[model samples]
Target: MKLVQKWTVFMLGLLVVSFGIVLTIRAELGVAPWDVFHIGLSNQFSFTVGRAGQVTGFVIILLSFVVGKIKPTLGTIANILLIGFMIDLLMLVVSSPTNLIIRYFYLILGTVIFGFGAGLYISAHCGTGPRDSLMMALDKNLSYDISIIRGGIEVGALSIGYILGGPVGIGTILIALGIGPIVGLSLNKVNQLKNKLQPKIDCYN
Candidate 1:
């Protein structure tokens, strides 16, 4: 039952994250750095954004394993497969808001939702997502602060994405600045909740 519950929460978190990604795209305001890279691939390669993400994620997972010796977990595999599919499915129905204000609203809301979703899944302790795994791998090998590694990766992604003609705007800036703090806060809160519940969950066993 605990295993079932954990996976349920993990899947739910991915679903929410996918919806958040689609919302950001629909806003047309720009997207997170890695997402910018995915969108760039979609534009250049004639793939859907979600398909592009899946391909990119697969490559990253491979690299993480090969170079970083990071084994893929079940959660990581699910993340690679499911988030992209969910994003594609949601994008079909979620329309762009024409109003500038509403677009900004979508941008912010999407970022927050994405953060919380990330927090929920991460706190489940199943595994880190592909990109995050890659970051951890890099941190292990390079011995750089995780923040520096993450920032470097995002900057690199953003640069390539911009060159590939992905959308770049204020929303990109907002996501870069806001997502960390939001995810941090959400993760802290979710972990706290989980800690509180764990004893009761264990009592059942």
Candidate 2:
């Protein structure tokens, strides 16, 4: 029963995060750096963005497993598959707002929701998603501060995606700088709530 609840929460988080991703893309201000790379691949290779994302995910997973020695968990597998599906499905259904102000609203809303979703799954403590696992693995193996490694990854992705003609805008910069703090805040809040809800142990005489 506990396992079921955890899985449910994880899947729900994935769905919410994927929706937020689609919303960000629809806003057209910019996209997450990794997503920019996916979009660039789609534009260059004539594949759908979702397909490109799946391919990229597989490669990253492979690298993380083979080179980084990170093992996969069910949550990791689900993340790779479900997030792509949700993003594609959401894209089909959700259209971009025409008004610039409305679009910025979407961007902000998407970023917040994305952070919340991350907090949900992470608080579950089942497992790390592929990208996240990879990030941690890289940090561990390379002996660099996680922040520095993350920054390097984002910069590399952004540069390659830009070179490949992915859309770049203010939102891209905003997400790069802001998402860490946002997600960290969400995680702290969620963890605190979880601790509060947990049954306290009583010591017997």
Candidate 3:
């Protein structure tokens, strides 16, 4: 695929991801570890969650580059700049539901959508966001198991976020347990779709 096309996909996927994130937030049940951190920062600083996320992403990018020697790619830069803004924008319109069933629906739907969005962006072959970059760096530098590294990072984030007054509940546990399998499934589907489309794309090219 062309560079522009790849960027288009990346941006679109980020938009979808942001929408999904907003849905989860609106559900008011809880959020992912990184999101908990973002929300905590927002609450502490009196800023939007998106702004908090942007600042966090910027810091992580710097740490990844300086400490881990991981260069930020175009996609990485875009991911930092775009997703947070989109999330804040979405939040302006997406209000939390008062009904219990509806809130759970939002949480579940958001999780699936988030997973699909992740798959789409990953399949674009641009680059990963700051958090993933950090994970890779830690895995490489620490010589630890990747799962252990990831779990450590997330648990640390979760702890800090909770201390900072972020919400924690069943939704957090649900996301933690369910997101991996959902993302795996979404990636498989995205790959299959990409494979099927490749021949058509080649013909057009």
Return whichever of 1 and 2 wins on lDDT.
1
Which candidate achieves the best lDDT against the true structure?
A: 1
Candidate 3 per-residue lDDT, tens place, 1-205, comes to 5667777877888998898889888999999898999988888997899999999998988888777899899889899889989999999999999999999999999988888888878778788899988898787689789999989999998999898988888789988998889888977987787778777662111
TM-scores, one per candidate: 0.93, 0.90, 0.95
- Model 1 TM-score, all chains together: 0.93
Of the two candidates 2 and 3, the one with more favorable TM-score, higher being better, is 3
Candidate 1 has its poorest 10 consecutive residues by lDDT at 196-205
Once model 2 is optimally superposed onto the true structure by TM-score, how far is the C-alpha of residue 148 displaced, in angstroms?
2.0
Q: Is candidate 2 or candidate 3 better by lDDT?
A: 3
lDDT of 1 by residue, 1-205 (tens): 8788888778888998898888888899999998999999898997998899999999998999888899999888899899999998998999999999999899989999988888877767777889898998898899788999988988999999999989988889998898889889988997777778777772111
Candidate 3 residue pairs in clash (backbone atoms < 3 Å): none
Model 3 misplacement above 4 A: 202-205
Model 3 residue 11 CA deviation in Å? 1.1
Candidate 2 TM-score versus the reference:
0.90
Alpha-carbon lDDT, every model? 0.87, 0.82, 0.86
**Model 2 per-residue lDDT tens digits across residues 35-125:** 8898899899977778788888888888887767888887787888888888888899999999999999999988888878887777777
